[model samples]
Target: DAGITQSPRYKITETGRQVTLMCHQTWSHSYMFWYRQDLGHGLRLIYYSAAADITDKGEVPDGYVVSRSKTENFPLTLESATRSQTSVYFCASSDWGSRNEQFFGPGTRLTVL
Candidate 1:
């Protein structure tokens, strides 16, 4: 039988630790976003930056922090990892317009034990 299948990805970590996830874009986009996906919340925005040195917290930004020092890079850090923070994190980038489409990354799944 000839079939194609995809492998599962996993990330494991301990509590009270710090983890940093990074995102980068090829284009010089002015806007970057970080989102976390959970069971009930679906996809919730964690943080977003309009430009360099300009960042704002999103809906679920309590345990997450984001920084944008350049147009092509945006890194998200978890201050203190917790079991409740186990979720998939996604990073996206877009140009400086409301009509522009946002491109998302493959996503990073982090599990805190």
Candidate 2:
């Protein structure tokens, strides 16, 4: 497998602007998730998908994503990015046998200006 990956290792955007972080994996995991890392909040779940068109919103972030149709790509879009959204975002995937064990991407560092 090609393993998990996150694009745009770093990004800078102004408030009210839009930003999209891309994630991909070759392992074809059934479960995928997006999370943001911050000091007080730690790793906060933004969104997740159990399969291709099946998705659910997490505790934070207004993001749009889909799997299966794209094969392995999961893109998260911030319709209007804000300074409060600045953080390191990560993507993870887990297989059927090990739902609790996940493989994470390198992470994308986004800075909202």
Summarize candidate 1's per-residue lDDT along 7-107 as a digit string, tens digits.
12356889999988878777777888888888888889999998999999999899888788787788888888999989888888878875868877778
The digit string of per-residue lDDT tens for model 2 on 29-85 reads 988899999998999998988888778889885644434456477888888888888
lDDT score of residue 20 within candidate 1: 84
What TM-score would you give candidate 1 relative to the actual structure?
A: 0.87
List per-prediction Cα lDDT, in the order shown.
0.81, 0.85
Model 2 regions lying over 4 Å from their true place:
63-68
